[model samples]
Target: MSDKDVAEDRAANADMRSAFDTSAAGPRPPSEITGHYSSDNPDMVQFVDADGNRLETTEANAPYAQIVEDMTSQDAREIYRDLVLVRRIDAEGHALQRQGELGLWPSLLGQEAAQVGAGRALKPQDYAFPGYREHGVAWCKGVPPENLLGMYRGVNHGGWNSNENNFHLYTIVIGNQMLHATGYAMGVQTDGDVATGDPERDTAVMAFTGDGGTAQGDYNEALVFASVAAAPVVFFVQNNQWAISEPNEKQFTIPPYQRSRGFGIPGVLVDGNDPLATYAVSVAALDRARSGQGPTLIEAYTYRMGAHTTSDDPTKYRSDAEVEIWREKDPIKRMRGFMEERGHAEPDFFDEIDAEADEIAARIRHACQTMPDPPQEAMFDHIYAEPHPVTERERAEFVEYQESFVQEGAH
Candidate 1:
């Protein structure tokens, strides 16, 4: 055939197929049928709406719906309790920061549902690696609210034991936990703890980050590693619509959930403000991981209802009108409204919860004020599991420096 004829034929065909392609250009997987984000064709998996109404399930959410249906009234009431308690803890943390108790606080004011939902779905044996703002998850993982504050309070490196709750120390560097979680998940597979067919024996790992973390190189690298290893982990990205001051538009054109498919992982987006939706979806994803299905990425579509940290003034970048709009969709409010509407909880039950929250807040305030400052020598205490010459020298120097101060006073 003539070169010109061959070129013309290729141009006429216009269909380019990569030799590496295994998935034919036909029907997409059920996990991928939900397209990119759009209000008109919204595919966000949600069981409840902002108005406290239980939504009708669609094909995308039917599996998750069964998970939610399996939840009892008592189960819901416990979740509601968790939501209230965590919100209170978050409030106390913020208030303490403002009052000069904590060095800084990352307020999780609007994300109780997202954190609590994912937290509650975890099995005790499942390991989780969290970013700095996952206070709600910490609470769900049985980390004392005060324990979380110790790190942010500048009192300790991290107070809780990872082995105790299978929850790692908070990673302050954005998106770094993804790698750690992926590695641990790979270890779980090596240990033969995954896909054992025994529900209790099989374990999974979870890594949490915000919408902004998805933009980080580490996050992408972890996904590549997890995909190749078929790691039993879930990348829970809380898309609170903003990554610090940057909105979704500034972050990326494609949302995190939509992008997971690029890495050969299943992805789903859920109403982050709805705990029921978040919990249902989380359960499904965790089940998939335990069943040897590998990693799944879930984007919890929520919002940042407060400042990024004690140091940030969100008012500079976002409008009060927008904040107010999200305030109406508050997770606690909606969950409470839903309970009341269904008569799942009585008025006195809510009243008791509020009263208990007040007491907890007071106790937290007391704890903050009374928290002892660690001795200056403690900075050198835990640097190494075994004795190290460098750390010992540093400790000695610090002690000498402190003794010199005392000598000066005596003189």
Candidate 2:
């Protein structure tokens, strides 16, 4: 055969096979599915609108309102402070990733309220299992912002000890935390920690996952286990519309919260952008769990304002208009409005909070830049809690290898 004919045949075959080759194609964002962000879903529990107006408490929102009514001005201010500080920390982390100070960053920009609300709702005795983007939750649980950046910076697996704060280490494997959370709740049950009349003695577990994680078998299995075991657990699903580039529509037609009904667990959908509503819903769910009412599923309908991570380019899949729509519903802006309208704090208070947020962001940046790389032995040292022969031998060999090189090169 002629070289020209062979070249043409090869090109044709490549074109034909490319259509079926999933690896060759980049991610495709779902076509704009309108309604979740607006008033289209009648079931969504919302206390504040995009313009910061306080809505009348409806039958659907009564539970959330009852919880909010019990909150003090001081509590509201604290929630707002957490939201602002979390945003600042998220921004600093993103900047560090962009500047090559960190290996990667998964920004929790628009979902701050969803995390902070649930995080603040939990008592110190309650345990939390979180996915990678739960930085806001980590912050509320007493984890320093620098501690969150360590994994991304390649300095350590996770800087904080999970047991100390009752918050598990961030799980990179999607939906795995759901299973872990369920198992932990089961353990709590086996330990006779539930059904205690004393609120202080009763403990509940909150498992956090993103919309993308709902597709995992582990998540469904966790739901099944929680349902059958009647474990005191709350599945907090932050449905940010898009799972990375793929929209929630691609995952399922119905919202994730509604799926809980199939598992015989109650489901509640809340306005994730409004901290007040999120806090209210979270309190209700956690309270239910603590009261030994079994598990509850909470779907926080929020949006992802930034790219999935520093490595992703969201502009390729989603439109600018879609992002702009969600920007108006920003949790921080809405919280500030709620606080101002209620006269929760003066303008000076806000200024002081802003200063504090700035300091935190600055500290995060400095810490990321100055973080020391993990020593060569860290890999072996932390592998086995007690001494293991395998790890010990490997460590010795590594040390010997390095010493041999140094001795031979000595002048």
Candidate 3:
């Protein structure tokens, strides 16, 4: 063939080859071409070192930390007290579940810092949306321990009224609360409860979820809604490293906090094991939201030191070595160390806290054991805002059935 003809023929052959190259074997591996977002980033914001030392930051980056430090000694003592009491209450709930007193109990053994820090950061008017695991957060929001235990004990759907405490009910469905929180925040915006430049009247919503929940469509949709609406909401994701047996690696190829970029919101990853760090990051995000800056995604890098719930056995899917590693970063221990190092607390104070914890534990155990089961009529009371005839009939039937069970000899 002539030179020009041969060049044209070669080009045609190349196009033909490209068109037919659909085989599994290719120039590049599929894995290499596929892009992924990370769910964990070690280099993200970390203000508290593992040694309990606080890292210095610019004046602008210091609001949350300054607030935490400015917490009165009484407030610090109250936080410690609340942490200990809630842990005991959590343990009791777990024990009750095992003893068949509860349907399930989600233990928050290692996440005290993330819960307490974020919980205490809220203003009184700020609303909170919590996953079922937010016993500590509920406690911080002034939810009585007995109220939380009552739910697990199957005595009530949820013990306390959400409106009463500015806290929503424990959402069992994963990631659902993110949408609720976003919707609530949108309402706040429309009502002009936020963006008024009045810190007191301005309101923000904080929604809590876990690493596993981050994989849910609701979580991502919530972010999209919040971002587009510029709603005053904080998406607080507690990355406790496991959604039951599945590790975080299975959920995301990259850190979750980075996912915020896709939705046009800032994402922050804090050391979840450090109470101070969690508080600082959460407070900042909430403040920003309250200031009408829109939503923020906070991935608190914590570890789930216990099973996903009382029924789950992490030993089947996770290693003892992994558990041991996270144990060293226990939130309570880190907080204690930080307090001691800074003279925020003393040995005597710790002793007092321990004694109080024991007392609280005893109280919770007694309360859980003695909590009365709801009357048969109670099941029908909150079924609807307005009374329903069908439900009333069913309620009557249930009450009759329960009454029929009473023996003639019974009082």
Which is better, 1 or 3, measured by lDDT?
Answer: 1
Clash pairs, model 3 backbone? 37-254, 38-254, 38-255, 39-254, 39-255, 39-256, 40-255
TM agreement with the true structure for every prediction: 0.90, 0.90, 0.85
- Candidate 2 per-residue lDDT, tens place, 108-149, comes to 999999999999999999999999999999988898889988
Most TM-score-accurate candidate: 2
Candidate 1 per-residue lDDT, tens place, 160-224, comes to 88899999999999999999999999999999999999989999999999989999999999999
In model 3, what is the error at residue 171, expressed in angstroms? Answer: 0.5
Of candidate 1, the 10-residue stretch with the lowest lDDT total is: 13-22
Model 2 residue pairs with clashes: none
- Give the local distance difference test score of model 2: 0.86
Report the CA-based lDDT of candidate 3 relative to the real structure. 0.80
